[model samples]
Target chain A: MLCGAGRDRDVLTQQLQRLGIVPVVVDAMSEPVAQEPCDLVFIDVDVGRHSPALGGGVDIPQDRPVLALIGSDVPSAVEWVIEQGACGYLVKPIRGTGILASLVIACHVFEERTTSTRTISELRHRLKARQLVCSAAIRIIDVFGIGEDEAFHVLKIGSMERRTTVEDLAAMIVSGELSVQALGSDVEARRLRV
Target chain B: MKSVVPIGILFSTQGPYGTVSRAMRDGAMLALEEVNADDRFDFRLEPHVQDPEGVPAAYLSCAQRLLREEGIKHVVGCYTSSSRKEIIPSFEKHDALLWYPSHYEGFETNDNVIYTGAAPNHHVLPLMDYVLRHVGRDIYCVGSNYVWAWENHRIVRELTQVSGGRILGERYLQVHDCDVDRIIDEILDRRPSFVLNMLIGESSYAFYRAFAEARRSHEALHDTVIGSCTLCEPELAEIGASACGGHLSSSVYFSTVETRVNQAFRDAYRRRFGERAVPCADAEASYNTVHLLARALTGTTPSEIEAVKRSLYGVAFAAPQGQVSVDSENNHSFLVPRLGVSRSDGTFDIVRESAEPVRPDPYLVWVDGTGVWASWNGRRRELTNRPRLRVIR
Candidate 1:
């Protein structure tokens, strides 16, 4: 499902097309993303950490498998998204067979029911997180007109420049307070041109 | 300058051995056609082919044939390490150049044989780094009783010992031998986390089936990992599709080993041979060897063996496996080691790799930083000191 919030739909189309995976744009909590019926979901999304008060907007449904595109060398960013609810995470811009591998891993992970937590609420929270991350990703993609990998880098570079943190920026995006328009030039351009 | 080089391909056509012979030949033929079609060699290189049908004696005979009837001075053939051992003397006797194309048991050395294949630097130690992480402890090494098995097992034993894994079991099958049921029984009993298979030909095919059929889970076997440098594109088809999956096969080339060099080689090969997949190092090395010989022949008179040898010794190229140069001292090459996991399509999905070629130390020694070659263990074999060459112009 294409995260409508930060999506370069054209590039998402091309990257997914290359891997033979096509994107369908929608809110993660809505129809298809909610039903968990997609053979697989290629989630080039942003995510937020968990907090008790104010109930951070999204939930993680443990039923579906999600492949997240992340930034390289930033272990914290990976940790944050994975914590939110990415079954399999790949650093961007995804090149070569990395996308295929992430898709495979995500499918296997969900099919195996191998996520660490067994609680239903935890599963719900994870799925909700996955959806918010998706929305933020769509926004990034729309503004950047780049692949999932570049959208991911935009979030990562924004976090670094904002001097706050990747998790916070990802959370801010997921919370619907920020848009892809905030991305810096360095973040917009990565391995491939934006 | 237009040139022609006679190279021999030693393969088996009958019984269980024909698969490798066919695949290696196919890979080479495709490469040759493309090389001949291109401007790279200025379309000047022409290759002469001979197939010995996997017979060592026949290989020697073919070398004699190429050297005598064909008037060929330099050659590439003999994929098996054992076959290479067999033909070394023929090269020495005839003063002809033999480019030994497969990663072999590294202990052998001959001035006439230029190995454009993996040394221990290319195969053994790189896998050792993997063993330390994934496998919990023991590594079982299985192979055929021959020079290749012995040399490889020795190094494997050392690496396992250093990694703190016991050499739980060491089993050997005679060449061209395949005793599946018995070998499987021993594997089940010992139940080492992983087995290092050095068995070549039909035996490897048999062992892979026997191991896969056994009811064992990956987690239970997670600590065990089989590392075989001997198994390449040729063995993949023989072992069948389902059997070799997820098992790591180390080599200088795998069909899926994506590099600028390998990709170009694969495309040229596929275009020339109808999109065929080549898994054998011997075939790829054979492909490179012909081009090397063609250059040398073009540069000088094709008639003399010594002149051809000099040209080869001094020659280097941007090879598909990377920029491999003949070690002037050892008649060897330092090429990169690439390792991959077997997939369903009889190719490997490259898992880990070295971006650049690792110079082959004919005897897998760790050379120092000063560009001075020294013993890895500091206990120099007679080979440690080759005939010292002096500048005498």
Candidate 2:
């Protein structure tokens, strides 16, 4: 829990413990709210408001889920906490009844967002690799007077022989680090005969 | 030696919905009397009665006085959702528990309150199925302008929209405003399959009377019926004989629910409150509340709210309705839903009932398996193709 010293903080700690969640307490006002090695962070905006470090500057880290422990339901305070990027909130004075629900919601939302981000990144990587392979295949088709499918087959054989990915071999050929004729069995056999 | 604990009873027994609220208060009082007479508990509950007089502001003051001035930790009261919400913050502030006994629109769970009533999943969702299957695909809605009406209409709209049903017309009016003649006329003009009546108290009764008066000679009024989630024997009695019969109601408990437990409960209630006493869903809920409180206070000090809450966990009561239990997580009760038709004598004839008690799903996590969507084949269809109805004032 990245919260400062107060009754609200104590109650929150006790509530988290009741839920069998052991919180690593960090005074966010005195310390910075950053990548903490914890599953979730419970920030006390009421306490942290006193310290300019949290009140004025530090943004709540998005790496782990954040649950704001708010003392007031005033629209501005709520909006401020939401602006600080809170996934969920528990109205203070903190009660045991609300902690579990807020924690569950914040963690679930964070995990879902994280999973979607990873999936998007993986899809981008695959797209980039496909583009590189296609570029290398087109170059081979122009140089060897072979069909695009035949060029891809040659790249596949070369990749297998080199124990590298087809995309990596394609990159090597496109970069001029490896010759396309060297990948052709016909050229290889002729060179061997010579 | 029995340790005496003071509890609070807050209800508006003289409000627009006073007839039904009085029944609930009587039911709670009967349970208290029974518990006091019983030797099973080592503790006794002394109730401090506070009437809100059906005023919303009065509820706040009454609940505050009970929890703060009286120093009572447990309160068994609040008939309407508005009244319940009014007193909830005070209950939470005082760390007291409010026993709310009413069938209401769901989507709330508070630790400071124990809801010993029907959740939407147990009442309206199941009723939606019965209406769609037994009634027709087209419906007209009439309701008192309130949260209960608005929320129920939303749920019914969702249910009907998904199931190839159409709502012909919808209307709302202020509480106690019996200006339902125009709405009733609109209903007749549209001639929807049935009317979903969400109007409470006198307004509801007035609507029934007006509808009956307008459609008295029409033979089709028999099939073109009124369906409700709030209708009960007491309300039917208020509606009078001319317009009472042929209406369908969905509730957790009907005075007509056939069971040895229910028969005994009904007899005891009548004997205590006189032969005129008719138990309804809210009344049974209040009765369950007192008994559950007694059971929870078995060995623990009733002063400690946490201890009482802990003791209530997994506590099940063999209530008049059936086997009723509180879901410890949300403090809402598990209840069996029953469908009934109002008979000529202002009593219901239970036509359908659940085989077992259904767990409370206030957040609607459990999609009712008895709905139309469950029977539908996976084919996408536009909601526009179905007949459309306009909501009238």
Candidate 3:
């Protein structure tokens, strides 16, 4: 994570000396290339008003992931960098210390990219949960003259009040098993509020 | 790209409270284009935007329309927390994900969402500390009577009492359509040294307009200055130059920060949508979310919903706002805070900024922290983490 440094040279040099990690300051005007013998390089793309990938600035080793520092919500730039073979992106204005933490996660994404992944249970749970939440929302909409969003909130609030997950609460709501007292009270509170 | 996830985003438009919605939308759209460009999402993740015309109900209806009629499984935007709250249960019901990109009061937590904005510690608390140290002793808290302002003021009231500030008055009105005359009269009558505004929505422009018309603009408020957690660049675009200049507001990302990171963002925005499309912290967060999601979906095609959501955990991005992380525990981004003084040109100067980014504390689980989990003015209530979790009648 390249954060809080006014100049790319200063920030790069400090991280290089302090952590003994190689540094590559990115200029937005060129294309990105990973440098050698450097475990990591923090690209400073914003200084030159250019994308790190298009900038050709970073020169980290081939095997290592090019950790590109991009804006937090610049999805277009993020996508652009990925298209140029950036392994990871660290949103700018990162906490000074958060740089270390960002490196940890970047390494994780890098490992997952090259390793075995996916589990059947994760898929099963996600599908079941989606069904339950959606069905419960439909039931709430059917029960009350409200939109799907409201129904979803009813289920969410019900789940929270009942101290359970939305899937669990949705299950109960669809089963006609969860008490209607909470939902009734919530509706009453809102009616009084508006 | 083989998998296409249709994402629906809900936000406001240029009605009154500045063009934050438009500016934010522009920023988000840029991100959407980037996210859908990946080879994995060949379906071209189409974005369905709802103006909601700044109505609370409209936000609910928009969420409903998107989820039911359009089958959108992901929601990425909402300007107001209340509007977001209104659709929380909807997202939950559909088992979809809502990545809220705004700062908010913290009193609740939920698992189906990610808050990319500042929670209490990063946003409200720091400003409170600043107001006490630099501003004054007496206070008038004003806001739209929605969840964000209502709960945000509650936290202010508590912290003010603890910090030796006198809470002279507190008032509320319906967002965007509130009767500002009455509220203005009350504030003038109270004559508090500083007005703490926690207002949002369409009427956000109206309140500032009233304050300026009453000659209570941030400039005129000398010993009686007005400070707000809201009222940033977007509000300025609505209020024009006079109502905005020197207005003290708090946020994480202000467009005027003098840094290489911000300069690049500003240049691109100017090149793409004109310099007027300067970014706030939330916009950066929204932009980063798309890139992070894209990086996560790089190797594998998310043929399954669970795969998409779970993969989002550790994806990192170098975004304009700052380097952000998806809290492995709670999934909210840890962002830094900045105090911006609005200029006449719909931009802000970084008057004050957090020494560093505060860790994402969406759950508010820090020791001696405040949340629904903590004592609020010596009371206990079950708080839920519903970002923009709205209550509907």
**Model 1, B1-393: lDDT tens per residue?**
645444554455543456665666665565566567766564344456777776655766777777777766666666665466546656676777777666765655677777777776667666555554454457787886555665667666766676677887777776677776676677667777667888877888888766766634333433345668767775776777767666767677666655688788877776665656564576677677666666665557655767877887777777776776777777777676666667656666665656566666655556321211121221111211111111001
Worst lDDT window (10 residues) for model 2 chain B? B384-393
Under CAPRI classification, how is model 1 graded? Answer: incorrect
Residue B58 lDDT in model 1? 72
Q: Chain A TM-score for each candidate, in the given order?
A: 0.41, 0.68, 0.41
The residue-by-residue lDDT of candidate 2 on A33-79, one tens digit each, is 68567778877765443324113335578788888876543333455
- i-RMS, every candidate? 24.5, 14.9, 16.5
Model 1 C-alpha lDDT per residue in residues A53-108, reported as the tens digit of each score: 21322444556776665522223334546765667866433444566666777787
Error of 2 at B391 (Å): 26
Over 4 Å off, model 3:
A1-194, B1-3, B14-18, B36-44, B216-221, B300-303, B363-393
Better of 1 and 2 by TM-score: 2
What's the TM for chain B in candidate 3?
0.83
Ranking by DockQ: 2, 3, 1
What DockQ values do the models have? 0.00, 0.02, 0.01
lDDT of 3: 0.62
